[model samples]
Target chain A: MPDYLAGIDIGSTMTKVVIMDNGIISSVMGPTGPEQRRLANKVMEEALRRVNLSFKEITYLVATGYGRINVPFADKQITEITCHAKGAAHFFAEARTIIDIGGQDSKAIKIQDGRPIDFVMNDKCAAGTGRYLEVTADALGIPIEKMGPTALGAKNPAQISNICTVFAEQEVVARLAEGVPLDDLVAGILESLASRISRMVNRLKVEKELVITGGGAKNVGLVTALSEKLGCTARVPPEPLLTGAVGAALLGKDMVGKALKQGLPLEKKERSLREISLY
Target chain B: MAEEQKKEERKKRKTATEAASKIGGMVKAAIGGTVRAKEEGKKLAYSFIVCSYDEIIRAMDIVPVWTENYAGICGAKRDAQRFLERAESLGFSRSLCTYALCGLGFDQWREELGEMPPDAPWGGQARPDMMLSSGQILCDPRNKWYQAAQQFMPDVPIYDVGLPWPMYEDDIEVSEIQDYYIAYIVAELRGLVKFLEEQTGRNMDYDRLSDLVDLGEKTWNLIWETYELRRSVPTPMGTGDAMNTMVPMVFMLGTQEGYDFFAELNRELKEKIAKGEGVVPDEKYRLLWGGGLPSWFALTDFNYFNSKGAVFPVETTYRMIEPTYRLNIPDTDDPIERLAWRWLGYWTYWFDKAKKRPGSEPDVERLIQYIEDYQIDGVVMHEAFSCRTWHLGLIWQLNQLKKIYKPIPVLVLGAGDKKSLEHRELPSLILESDIVDISSYSEVDTRARIDAFIETLESTKKSKADQQ
Candidate 1:
C-alpha cells in the first residue's frame, strides 16, 4: 500500500483537512465553530471519504494552527507559521515572503530554501486581522463577500485614523452619516487594514516573490491594497484557505519519507477516525 | 467568557539552580529589615538600584529601602493591581512606568493611614526619612519616582544628584572626556556623602568607606567570573535562575553575603558542568535575552522556553557586573574617587570597540559578542510597554545587527548581469508585555508566538545542516 498522509488545520475561524499520496488526493474546509474537536473530526472524515481511504491506512498525520492541540487523532502537531511557509513554498517555490492574515492574528514569515527562517506576528490586537473586517462589515450591514467588490468601485476612499476596531466602527458610522459613499468607506477600511499589515511585514524587509494566504486573501480588495502598499505584486494560492492544511500534509509526507529512508519505524498514534466527545 | 479569559494567577516557574529558590526568603528578610530599622530609630533612605550608592550607604550606617525591589516583589506576588489602580485614581496615567506608579500609590495610602497598605506585599515598603533620586543618563523614572512619592510625605527631603557621563562620540577619545566625567561623578558621590552626614549626624569614616568599596569591587569581579562560566556547552544555569541571583548582586552589594553567594554559585555551576548537567536536559538551542526588562508576573515564560529545548545562558538585563580587570583607571587613594572611576569604566567599557564597528552601538556589539561567545542559535527580547528607558531603540539595535551580520545568503543582482549572494540575520523573537502590568499580558497569545519562533529555529537549523 502507498503512504497515505493526512494533515488537519483547526484555525480560529476555520477548519481544514487535506489527504496526500505523492500529491493532494482530496481537501475540505468549513467554518470552525465552538466545538473544535467535533469540527476537526468532521472535516477530516470528509477529506478521507473523498479519497476512499480509511483511518488505519493513513501512514502519518500532522495537525496545525491555533486549535491544533484539540485534534486527538494526530501523530504530531506543528505551528501554523511553519506549516504555511511549507505550503506556500510548495505552490511558489521562489517566494521568499509569506503574508498570512488569519481570523484572530496576522503574521509575516520569511522563507529561505523552502523553510521559514524568521517571522513577525501581530500583537494582542484585532485591528489588523480578518475579524476586524468582519466586525466592520457587520456594522456596515453589508455581506463580507460583497465588501470587496463594493470597495473596487470607490472614487475617493474615506480616511480612517483610528486603530481600534470599535473606534473605527464609529468613524465609519460618522462618515456614513456625512453622506460618504459606501464603496469609499469599504475601500478605506480595507486600505487601512492593509497599511497595518504591511508595516508588520516590512519588519522582515519584504523580499520577493511574496505569497498571501489564509481566509483574508480571498478578498480581492485587500490583496490589491496590500500589494500597492508593499510596492510589489503578491501571488495568492488557488485556494487560499487550504495552504495551511496542504503544508501540514506536506510535512507529514516528509516525515514518512524520512523514516522510510532511514529504515526507522515511524511513531504514530493509534487513532480511530471517530468523533471524540471530550469537548 | 471574559472572566475565563482573565487569568490573574501566573504559572509557577521551575528553577534550574538550588541558589535561586532561596531568593524569596532573601527578599522577605530585606523588606522586613527596613521595617525593623525604622522601629530601632535608624534612619531609612529610599534608593534606586544602579545608582552606585549602596556601599556609601552601608558605610554611613543608613538603611536603604530599595523601593524598586519592593515594587518588583509586589509584581511577582500578583498583588500590584490594587496599588496600580490607586495610582490611576490619583490621576497618574497608565502610560507611565508601573514600578513608579506602584510605589507612589503605596506611599500615598501609607501616609493617609499612617501604616502599611492593606494586604501589602511583605508588610509594605517602609516609610523613608529621605529620598535619594539619581539623575542618570538612562531611566528618567529613577529621578522622578521618589520625588513623586515624596509629595505624600512632605517631611522627607529629596536629594537629586547628577551622575552624567560623556555621550559616546566618534571623534572624542575616552581620555578627552574621562577626567570631566570622573570629576562630575566624584562631586556627586561626595554630595551624597554630605547629605547622609547631615541627616544621620555621622562623621565620614574613610577607612570603613574604603573597605566597603573594596568589598564591592571584589563582589563585582566574582560576579563576572561566575556568570562567564555559562559559556559551557550545556550551560549549567540559565537566566531564570539569574533573576533570583541578581537579588544579592544588586541589593547586597557591599556585604560579604553577596560575595559569598557568587562564590557558592560558581562552585555549584562548576560541579554541574563537570557532571554534564544543563538547565534543560537536552539543550538544543542557546538563546540570548538580548534587551528590555522582564515581565515580573510571567517569569515562567523562561520555563516555557525551557520546555521547548531553548536555554538562555546569558542575558543583557540585570547582569550589570562587567570585568574590572579590563578597565584602565587612575590609581586613587580616596574611596569616592575609585567609585567614580569604576562607574565611568563600567558604562564605557564597550565604547572603543563599538566605535570601531560600523552600524553597531554598544548594546548591539555586546549582543554580537555574547552570541559568538555563548554559541547562541537565536535571540529573544522582551519589550516591556512601559519602560522606554531600556525598551526604546532595541528595534534599531536589532536592525543594525541584521545589517552588519549577514549569515544567510540570498541571491541579488551584482555589478554585472550575474546573481550574487547577500546575507540575512539570525532568527529572533520579540515578546511584548509590560514589566508589572499583568492585565496587558495574555499567556495564550505569548505561547503561540513562542511556538512559532521555535519552529523557525528548527527549520533554520535543518537548512544549515543540509548546507553543510
Candidate 2:
C-alpha cells in the first residue's frame, strides 16, 4: 500500500489538479469552471479516478489559488503567495524571487529562507494578465496558443502604447488597419506587458535565482523579454502551473501530521493507498 | 461670395441674440436679492454661513456665490502657498488633501476682502446673510471644515446639504441618507429665512421660493450635461481642463449664469461627440484608476501612465461621490439636519457603512460592475502612503476578480511622500514609484527596471500561448 496526496489550484480562468503518491507525480491537469464548489468536486473526482484511489484512502488534500476559500474538501487553505513560494522553493531551493503571472493577475513575491517575506499583486485591472493576451489573440484572429512563437518570429514588432486589455484591443485593431505586421504587434504587446511585470518584481529588490511560474511562464518570448529586461538569468519550473497546487498539497500533508502530533483525531479511515479521502 | 458673407452675418446675429438672453437672466437674479435680518441692530443670530446649492440658492431669495469666486478678492491663488503655510502652522499637515485646506484658507482671507489688492475685483466684501456647502467630502472631514468656519466669521449661519456616498445608485442606504439630508436642508433654510426677516423686517415670500426651485432644476440639468460629456472616449476635455471646468460649478452652483455657461459648454461638447473627435486624441488604453488624490509631489506619474496609452475612465472614491448631490433637496423648514447629513453621508468621510456587517464586498461588486459596464481594460490600484481602507481590502478584491475575470490584469503600485521614498527598508513602497529614488537607482537603472517588467508581461503572454 502507498500513501496518497492531492493538490488543487482554483484559478480565475481554470482549475488544475495534481495527485502524488510517495513523492512521484501520478496525475496532472483537470477541467475547472467559474463556480468554485462545482470545480472542486470535478477536479477531485478526476484525480481520484486517475490514481484508482477511493476517497477514504487520501491522507491529505490541500487547496490554493484565488478560489481557495470555496474548497470544502481541503483540510487547509494557504495564500497563493505562500503556496507559490513553497512550491518554487521545493523546485529551486535557493530561488530568491518568485514571479507568478496567472490568468487575471501578476504577482512578484520575495522569498527568504523558504518564507514569503513580501509580495506585490495586481488584481484591480486586466491589462498585464493572461486576459490581455487572450483578448489580443482573439482580435488578431490567432489562437492564443500560437501567439508566443509567432511573436518571436517577427523581426520588427510594432509599438503598442496601451497596456490595458480593452484599450489595447482598440489599438491592435487600428494597427491592423494601418497594415502593421501581426508579429510586430504581438512583440509590442509582449514588450509592453513585460514592463508591468518588471515593476512588480523590481519593487521587491530583484535578487538572483528568479523563478517564473503560473500559466504565463510557458511563453518563451516573455521569458526572453524578462531575462533581457532584468539582465539576469531566469528559471521556470517543470509543470510551472502546477507549482501552487503542489505546494498546497504538501502543506496539507504537513498540516495533517501536525494535527495528529497535537493529539487531534484523524478521520476514522486508515492511511492506505487504495482508500483515500478525496477531500 | 456675397451669399457666403450674408450667411456669416446671420450666424453672428444668432450668437448675439443668445448672449443677450443670457445677460438678461443674470440681471434678473442680481436684482431679485434679499437683505439679511438682525436683532438689536447686531445680535448675530446666525452662528455660521454656507453657500447654497444652485437649486437651493435659487429657491431662496438670495444670491449664490461659490467660495472659489472669492479667491481673487482673497488673493488666494497668489497667496495660496502662504495660506497653506499658515494652516500647517495651525496643525494642518501637508498630508491633508490640499484642496480642502486651500478652500478653508481662502475663506479665512475672504473675511478681510476690503483690504485686498486694488486690482482685486470683488474685494471679498460680499458677506452672505447665509451660506451653504454641498456634501463633497473628498479631503478633510466636512464637519471639521464647518467647525473651522467660526474662526473666520464668528456670527454667520452655516448650513450643509447632505450628499450621499457611492452616488447615482439607489440602494437601502438612500432612505437613511434622504432622512438625514432633508432634515438639515429644511432647518438651515428656515433659520436663514428667519434671520433675513428679522434684518429686513419682512416675512418670507412663498412665491420667491417657487421661483428659486425652478432655477435650481435648470442649473442641475446643465451640470448633468457636463458629466455626460466625459463619457465620450478620450473625453471632451483633458484632465487639466476638467479641473478648470469644475470652477463654474463651485463658484456659481446656484446661479442662472452658472447654469447658462455649463449649458453652452454641454452643447459644444455634444457637437464634438457627434463629430467623433476626442478632446485628447491617440488614446490607446482605457484604464480605471483607484486611489485618493495622487501625491502632489509626484503629479507627473499620472501623466506617465496616461502617455502609455492608458486613459483614466473613472477615478475611485473622490469624483464617484460627487453625483450624490442630486438626491435630497431642502423642501422643509428644518435645513440643518439636511445640511449635516448631506456633507457627512459621503462614504469615505465618516464611518464607511460599506465596511460594516455586509461590509465592502458589495461595494467591490458594484465597482467591478462599473468596470465591466465601462469596458475597462485594467485596474491600477495605487496603494498610497496613509489610505488604509483602500490598501487593506485591495488584495481580497483583486483575488476575487481574478477568480471570476481571469483575463484582466490588476497592477498594484505603492507610492508615498518624499520621506517614504528615502527609507531603504521600504522596498515595497519604493519599487512602486515611477521615478525611482535617485540615490537607490540611477536614471538608466530605473528605465531598465521598467522596461524589464514590460518584457516579463510580454513574455508571459507569449509562453502561455505556446503552451496552449
Candidate 3:
C-alpha cells in the first residue's frame, strides 16, 4: 500500500484536486456549481481514481480555497494565501511574488521560501478577475476559452476606462454601437486587466521572479501583456490551475511529517487519516 | 453551522441586543431632543463625529445632532438602504460614503415632509437650525456631508472647521510647524463660536464654556483610564462593548452624564478584573483590534472570536481615543485656545512618539505599544471600504509592523532544554466590509477567515509550547 497526500481547492468558480503518492502526482478540475460539498467529494474521488488509490489509502489531505470549510472529509483546512505560496515555491523555488487571478478575486502574494511574507487582495469587486474576462467574452460573442488567443491578434485595441464590470459592459456596448471591432475590444479588456494586476503587484513593491497562477495563467494574451506590464518574465506552473491544490497537498505532507516526528499517537483505524488541524 | 458557533452567535446576540437596546434609547432621546428643542424654540446644530464641538454647542445652549450617529443607527437597524437609495436618486453616486449618503437622504426627506419620514429609525434624525461641518484632513465626507445637507435646507447656515495636520515627515521642525497649525484651528473654533452666537440670539458666556470644556477634558481622561484597565489578563470588556460605551465619548463628550458613565464603567471594569471575570472564560489569545471603523451590522463578529477564546485587549480604532493628558496646552485664560490645542493634540498624539523611536511609523508604533501593554498575540483589523481616512493606510501599517517589530515569546515548553520558538511578527487578519453596508459583508466568509486566524494563533501557541 502506498501512502498518499491529497489537497482539494474548492474555489468560487472551479474546484481542483491534487494527490501525491511518493512524488507521483495526479489532479483533476471541474466547474464548481451551487453545491460545494458535492463538488469537493466528486473532485477528490476523481483525483484519487486517477492516482489508482482509494480514499482510505491517502495518508493526509488538506482542503483549501474560498469554500474550504465546506469539505467534510478534509483532514485539515488552510487559507489559499499560504497554499499558493507553497505551490509557487514548488514551481520556482526562488519565486518572490505570486499574482493569482481567480474567478472572483485578484491577489498579490509576496512569497519567500514557500511562505507568504505579505499579501493584498482586491476588495470585493469583479473588476480585475477571471470573471471580467468571462463577462467580456460573453458580451463579445466569443467563447470564454478562446478570449485569450483571439486577444493576441489585435492590431488596434479599443480603450476601456471603466475598472468596474458593469460600467465596462456599458463601455463595450457603446463601442460596438460606434463600430469598434470585437478583437480590439477583447485585447483592450485583457490589457486593462493586466494593468490592474500590475497595480496590486506594485503595491507590495516586489517585482522579481514572478509567477502567475490560477485559471488566468492559461491565457496566453494575458500572460504576454502581464509580462510586459510587470517588466519581467512571469512563469506559469506545468499545470497553472493545480497550484492551489498542489500547495494544499504540500502542507498536508508537512503536517504529517511534523506530527510523526513529534512522536504523537496516530489514529489506529485504516479508514481514519488522523486529524491534525481543521484550519 | 456547528452547535458551538450557533451558541456563540447566540451569546453575541444577547450582548448585541443589550447594546441595541441602549442605542434605541439614545437615538430616541436624541431625536426627541430635537422635537423638544423645536417646542422650546432652542437652536439645533448638526455636526460630525470627533469634531470636538459638543461642549461648545452645549455651552452655547445649542442642541448638537450628530449626522454620523444617525447613519450608524440606520446601519445597526439594517434600515439604511431606503435613505441610501434616496441619496443616489438625488444624483449622488453610490460609491460615495454611505454615512454621508444616508445623512443627506434623511435630511432631504425630513425637510421635504416637514417631519420625520414614515417608520424612520428611532423617529428620524432632527432637522438642524445650522450645520457645523469639519473639513479635516482625515475624512472627506465630514467636509461634504453637511454641505450637501445644507442644500436641502437653504435657510440653514453652515460653518466648516478645517482641522488640518502635518503628516509626519523626517525633514521638518514638527513642534514649530505644530504651533502654527494649532493657531489656525483655534481661529476656526473661535469662528464657530462667533457663528453660533449669531445663529442663536445669545451672547457667549466664557465661564460656562470653560466649565463645559473641563468636563469634556475629564471625560477623555476617564475614558482613557477606563480603556487602559482592559490591559489586565482576561480583559473585562472587548472592543464590541467599547463601540457601545463610546456613544458618550463620541456624542456626549462634554456632559457630566458622559463623565458619570465612565466613572461607573471604570468601577465595574476594575471590579470585574479583581473578580477575574472577562469577556470570555479560559482566555487563550489576546488580540488587538488594530484599526479601521468596524462593520456596524456585524459587530457581534467580535464575540465570535470570544467563542474561540480570543479576547480583544485593545483596538486602535475610533475607540482608542487620543488621551487628553498628552496634549501640551500653553497657559491660556481662554478655554477655546485649550480646545484648539486639545484637538491638535488628539490628532498628533502618535507623531512625536513615532518620530522618537527608530524605524517607527506612527500607526505601527501605536500597535507595538498596544501589543506590549495589552499582551496581544495577534492583530485584527476591519477594512471598511467606504472610509479612506482609516482604511487606506492599514495595509501599509501592517506591512511596516511586520518588517520592524520583533516577535515576543508566548511560553516555552521545556524550561531547562532547547525550546521551540514561534519566531516572527504577530499574525494579523484584515476583514473587509463596509461601515454601513450590510450587503458588502458575508458572514460565512468572515467567520471562516476569523476561524482560520484563531487556529493560526492556537498553532503558534502550541508550537511555542512544543519547543524542545
**Number of clashes recorded per candidate:** 0, 81, 3
Which parts of model 2 are misplaced by more than 4 Å? Answer: A1-279, B1-54, B58-80, B91-97, B100-140, B152-185, B192-212, B218-240, B294-303, B316-366, B380-468
Q: Please report the TM-score between candidate 1 and the true structure.
A: 0.95
Where does model 1 exceed 4 Å of error? A36-38, A274-279, B1-11, B407-425
**Selected candidate, larger TM-score, 2 vs 3:** 3
Cα lDDT of model 3 by residue, A23-93, tens digit: 63788898885654354677777877886788878888888888776466787778888788889899899
Q: Who is ahead in DockQ, 1 or 2?
A: 1
RMSD of each: 3.6, 23.2, 5.5
Supply the TM-score for candidate 2. Answer: 0.43
Model 1, C-alpha of B101: deviation from truth (Å): 1.7
DockQ of 2: 0.03
Poorly placed runs, candidate 3 (over 4 Å): A35-39, A139-143, A147-158, A166-186, A265-279, B1-28, B164-183, B282-286, B307-310, B357-364, B376-383, B395-399, B406-429, B445-468
Compute the DockQ of candidate 3: 0.19
Candidate 2 Cα RMSD (Å): 23.2
TM-scores for candidates 1 onward, in order:
0.95, 0.43, 0.86
